[model samples]
Target: MGLDDIKRRIAAAEERAGRAPGSVTLIAVSKVQPEGRVTAVLDAGHRVFGENYVQEAQGKWPDWRNRWPGVELHMIGPLQSNKAKAAVDLFDAIHTLDRMTLARKLAQQADQQGRSPHLFIQVNTGDEPQKAGILADELPVFLSSCHDLGLSPSGLMCIPPEGHDPLPHFRLLRRLAHDHGLPHLSMGMSADFESAIAEGATHVRVGSAIFGDRA
Candidate 1:
């Protein structure tokens, strides 16, 4: 299966939920995936691909831009402060803006380049220590600080831990998006995306379901 099959499957998922098909953006998580596969998806008209590593993106994005200039790229992994500048130069959006320091770095770097990619504030939906997201309770304060920098966050993103019922977790992200006036909710992935769609995930990152176990 590939991007075409993923599109049809997502359409079916939406139809099952009584939602109109094509309402959600399918962010193909291409982390550690071959650049050839990314091109194949782009060739199939699936333009948005998500990359988790800056190094992988560094190689793939330039070639992608040379090939499919209209394609969109999103950084869907934890972003470290040292690599913020590289991310600013490459990705069209970063989905893991969880700390004030990193947000500031991104803003400054984006300003240096005279461009601001779409941004997402990742929240720890399950409050997992190992996750790279602001805690639900800490969001308001964090947002206020980010607001001082005049960065209008585009949305909230999260990844619920495995084995948890994802509906409630997805709902929490939706609520966080709405309460914060965010228009996008980046939730779900290959495994629980259907449940996520039912709970109002505006963006679902699909990988194995599309590329089939790149590992």
Candidate 2:
């Protein structure tokens, strides 16, 4: 599927879910994709994009931002604390604020820079030991710590365990966001975005379905 196809599908999902059109942001994941394919979507008037690596985004997006006015970049991968300054400068939103160290780093950078990107807490709803997210049971405490550090996350994000039904995970994330008074839910991808929309996702990250598979 291409950008237009994904947008149309998102629109349909919104209609099905009784959500207002354009309420869900579509973050076209551009990590590791070629310049040609990435520019193709840019030329198509899509401005929101996601990247998984700080260095990769640093190398390309500065030029792309100049070329494409109004472009918005999101960091959707695990964020290392050492890269917090660079990430805070480069991304318009960060969907992977999991650990407290990274949170403190981001907060310090934000204070130093006088501005900060929108933040989303990545929750390990599946409790996968290998994943990089705050476990569901630990989110409240983590969130409180973040607040104490002066970092306010506007949303919650999660990647459900592979091969499992994602609806339950989506519902859990939505509930978590609600319980915490967070307004946004960044969940879903090309495969389960429709289900996510139905479960009240405010943002969806789609990669291969839009930019084609990475080599």
Candidate 3:
């Protein structure tokens, strides 16, 4: 899909929600897509992108960033603690901070590198058995633990269970962020982004809608 189409969708969603224009950040999820496709997106003037794995991102984004300094990379997958340093080194933001051990590791990496990527606490709003996130009720204590470890996250992030209406989950995430005095809400994906925006998503990670089916 074209960038214009994505922008239009965003505009329509924001309008429906009565949110001011540009209130949300569109993270074109480029995970598993080829380098040429990513290059095409950059050539089309899109900057922010999300990747599912740190190693996959390392293969292409470093050179791309050198050529286009305006680019911003976001790590939107389950990050392993061992890869925390590499992730902290490359990504401009991290959207899957789900555990205290990872938080502490990221904090250490950030301090050592002298740069800390913006963090989003991933909450398993749906309470799914297979998902990687802090359980909804554990969010408060987890957020507090992150703070104690000096990993002050920007907001919350979640992926509602597949095949379910995501509106309620999005709304809950927004409320959680608000109650915690957080400013950013990174909920929503290609399928339910509109609903997420209507509820109050500050960032939407879209993949298939923008890049077509992954090859």
In terms of TM-score, which candidate is strongest? 2
- Tell me which of candidates 2 and 3 scores higher on lDDT: 2
Regions of candidate 1 where Cα sits further than 4 Å from its true position? none
Q: What is the TM-score of each predicted model, taking all chains together?
A: 0.94, 0.99, 0.97
In the range 1-215, model 3's lDDT, one tens digit per residue, is: 66779999999989888999999899999999877887888998999999999999999888889998799999999999999999999999999999889999999998899999999999999899899999989988998888887888998999998899888899889899999999999988888888888888999999988888899
| Window of ten residues with lowest summed lDDT in model 3 | 33-42
On residues 91-142, what C-alpha lDDT tens digit does candidate 2 reach at each position?
Answer: 9999999998899999999999998999999999999989999999999899
For residues 1-215, could you state the per-residue lDDT of candidate 1 as single tens digits? 67777788788889988987789899999888766776777887778889889988897688778877787889998888999999988989999999999989987887788888899999999989887899999999988888888777889998898898888889999888889889888999988887888878788999988887886
RMSD of 2: 0.6
TM-score of 2: 0.99
Name the top lDDT candidate: 2
In model 3, the Cα lDDT at residue 121 comes to 93
Error of 3 at 155 (Å): 0.6
- Residue pairs clashing, model 2: none
